[model samples]
Target: MADRWYPMGVPSFSRLAHEVPEPGMLVAHDRALYRVIVVHEDHPANWAEKDRNRLVQNRRAVEERKRHRARPLPREVFYPSPLDGWDGSEETWPNRPRGVELQPMAGGKRLHAGWPHPGWAYWYPVDEHHPVCASCGEPFPCREVDAAKEAARQMVKVEKLMAVGPSCCWHCGEPITSRQGARTFPGENLLLPGGPSPSFHQRKTGGCLYAAKEYEKKWREANPDLAETADLFGPADA
Candidate 1:
């Protein structure tokens, strides 16, 4: 009874009112509400044919749907792994070994399974949506991800990770560890003279070493009173 449904197809108000004679079955016709109504007779200006032919079949479908158990759907994981590229596929992970079959996600890009991705992984209808970067947490066409990629490339160029160790400057012969070490001298000279450099100092007293050494050299030449044996790293009074 409660689960029962009315007829399908177009509703004939006249036929229904005549057969059932329900109290609230009255329908408006020509500005006057009547128990029975006619179809296509008034030529109502607002009502469309599709809407006018109203039908509600199998109200049981709603009740059945409420009681019906749903089929188990596959689990969806968002945000593909950042290390998928670096770590090889041989290593088993959650939902890995047997990778969850992806059906062309929201954007063209799906979850990053691993290196050597199949054609199907990238298969998706063309759309305006762009893929999101896992590391930066920004969508594609993101300037931050672009900058990060560039920084990685620069790091490779500066460090030469595959090489033995930190590279020494070809001209200066000094160990170049960081990117800043590659800078040239004040004179724009790539190489410093093998003899002496200003940055290095010889003295250990109150005055700066380079300055003290320069002063000592100048004082020795000018005063000529102090012996050349005054010493470089000894007490200032000496």
Candidate 2:
């Protein structure tokens, strides 16, 4: 019923002629459920334009078929007939179309159906009971799953950093040893606020230096007065 309001599920298609349902309402057509996205009155000009395009497309398709029919079949098919050993029994010589082939079996050869028709042969509608998010239109529990994954990753990272010990570089999470140049920042660490200040290895590409600068920038923004007097960027440790 178009006049009747459907809270959920597919509405009757018979009443669609009386009144078109508003956008977002689900309707059943040819046993498949579809969500009506838009409703508008058909224009005569639009129909005429469509008819002209259809005629052009039909003519082009006909011409393509004629051209295909004119072309000769593959040379291999003519040189040796694919049906050379057919015994005239339906079981032995099942209809082997142009592309079908025969493969060796335990006793003899058996017909293989070959590849299926190109593209999707059939499409099944989404189950009505299938859960989906109203906001994102993604499968149900989308954001919650993503949030959980992120939390798990963060927990793993924290455990790894703990295993590396406090003397490790905050940026790369590796212990600062005598092998590489290391520098320490003297401000409140942005990653571990109120905790001990973190040090970073002076990588050749200055990646650690950039991370330190970013940390200092955030610290300066938080404590402007202290940042103005503090020398956060000190010389690298020998």
User: In terms of TM-score, which candidate is strongest?
Assistant: 2
TM-score of each candidate structure, all chains considered together: 0.16, 0.39
Please report the candidate that would top lDDT against the real structure: 2
Give the alpha carbon lDDT tens digit for every residue of 156-200 in model 2: 866754554588888877778888777666667667656567787
lDDT of 1 by residue, 105-213 (tens): 2234323222122322222222233344466533342445445656887676545322322344333333545433122112221112332212212224333343434
Listed per candidate, the RMSD to the true structure in angstroms reads 32.0, 20.3
Q: List candidate 1 segments past 4 Å from native.
A: 1-126, 133-141, 161-186, 189-238
Candidate 2: pairs in clash? none
> Clashes in model 1: which pairs?
none
Clashes of each: 0, 0
